[model samples]
Target: MVVQDRRGGGTVAVAMACGTGLAVGLLTSGCSPDGAAADDQEPAGRAAPAAAEVRDSADALVRAGSAAVRTSMETASGGTRVAIRGTGGYDFATSTGRLRVVLPDPAGRPSGGHQPITEILAPGALFMKNRGAGVPADKWVRVATASLADGNLVTGGATDPLAAAELLRGAREVTYQGEEWLDGVRVRHYRGTTDIGAAAAAASPRTAPALAAAGDGFTTGEVPFDAYLDEAGRLRKVRQWFRFANGAPKGASVTSTTELSGFGTKVAVQLPDERDIYAGKIASPTP
Candidate 1:
């Protein structure tokens, strides 16, 4: 999907199918209602780490580069609501990853009326299995990484796990909000806000260009962030809320959350065979 950014003066392809609007391809549902509970609870099994420590650990993970992740986003604009969910793994060393996301309709249910879309990012291209109407039933559509720069701004383009981790490293005025259980793993929650430029600057190189493009013409004020870290200091969950000061489309505000597990897990993704992939121009979804 693609949206012409009237404010940004650029045409941006919506990167993931998770949600509509600026941010896409996030797993917004399936979360426990107490996901963002208050931090007033007393010290439980493990003590929470300092804000700096949490940032450092996330930075280290980005530097090391392999983890399984589940990402989601929920957005509301002009009375339209969307929710997206995806699960995949990233390999920072090779700048590659794979993700499968259930694209949401304006009403927040799965769109496409078919299976979830699967995307694989290699060194120079992105391969996708899209089951949307009019797409071939078999074979993958390949897109050059460069064509994704504009779309990637909010989607983070390649793998969201790495970009999400890097975004946490930019948090300022960090406060340890307390402890919580995520998928049964005890984690320390921290809250803070980050400048849009700083967050874009801190993202992994693979997705930074898109971040830069997305921030154009928009007054991206402070973006609130919430991060949860496990005892080993691995990033368990990260959420960012984007609210532009200016140039925001009417009713468009995006919130993205990504959860990580299987840290250090080795994941290998191979590109599809040339005979089995389509490298031609794809017809953009009708506006």
Candidate 2:
């Protein structure tokens, strides 16, 4: 496995860990409200804005800043499904955050996928556990964000609110879908389509190369997305659909839906026990 940082740092190929069937690429990289109101005169106190005010505001919500979010997504390649669900927080102000990945098996089946993986991010370092198979259980691998190749993090089960929002920033068409309730809040729903290449670039430029490498000749045409936002203009939910015109790398399409809540919440991350961390890299496995 080769680990690089976000900057142009040097790359290092180390033993690849197969914990929970996690791909090497993943190691790296890695909505809204509702409304109502009556017509005719004004209805009592301040009623929520009308349907017209629920227009697409993805860009505003994305650029508004960072917040804590709960994420769940699944990627299908060929006929197998890889599901990753976790709770993490991103601070848009600093463009940094942490996530705890609950790994599942290769087929996302009930058996064989329980390895523990945790990622911590600061300004330049991304510290993670179980970089590869056979590595000491007590050690955390550290990789420089600057040195990582493009798109490496993106394919690595990383879910960032700011990055996800970036995909919506360049939407080709954003239309009001209607109203829906999520987590007990009524939110306005909006749908749109955006160029996958451009959206990936905007979300995280570093992941572009990795995405290309992973998809190689695969075509990711316009990606359709649905977003739900509340009256406060905060994002509540986002659903994305990606399909390849020529054909998906896995012979099927991929869809991921992320739900957000507890805006302006604080996410606390603690480093794992130092006694369990191994500073040396594991050797590459024999062919």
| Most TM-score-accurate candidate | 1
Clashes of 1: 8
Model 1: colliding residue pairs? 18-25, 26-72, 26-73, 26-84, 27-71, 27-72, 27-85, 153-210
* Candidate 2, backbone clash total: 39
**lDDT tens string, model 1, 1-287?**
53222223323223333221223422222222335535453344435345566556556676557888787766543334455677898786776788887764433345454367787766545667763434575777665543443324344323356555655555677767877899999987877776546766776666565445545523355557778888777788887775433223332345778777887789888878898776454554444
TM-scores of the models, in the order given:
0.70, 0.61
Report the lDDT tens digits of candidate 2 across residue range 66-154.
56666655544333344566567766555566777665543344224455467665444456675455566657766554344322233
In model 1, which runs have C-alpha deviations exceeding 4 angstroms? Answer: 1-51, 62-65, 77-80, 105-112, 122-125, 131-135, 143-153, 156-159, 200-207, 217-221, 243-251, 273-277
Q: Which stretches of candidate 2 lie over 4 Å from their true place?
A: 1-66, 77-82, 106-113, 121-126, 142-154, 197-218, 243-252, 269-287
The window of 10 residues in a row where model 2 has the poorest summed lDDT is: 25-34
RMSD of each: 7.2, 10.6
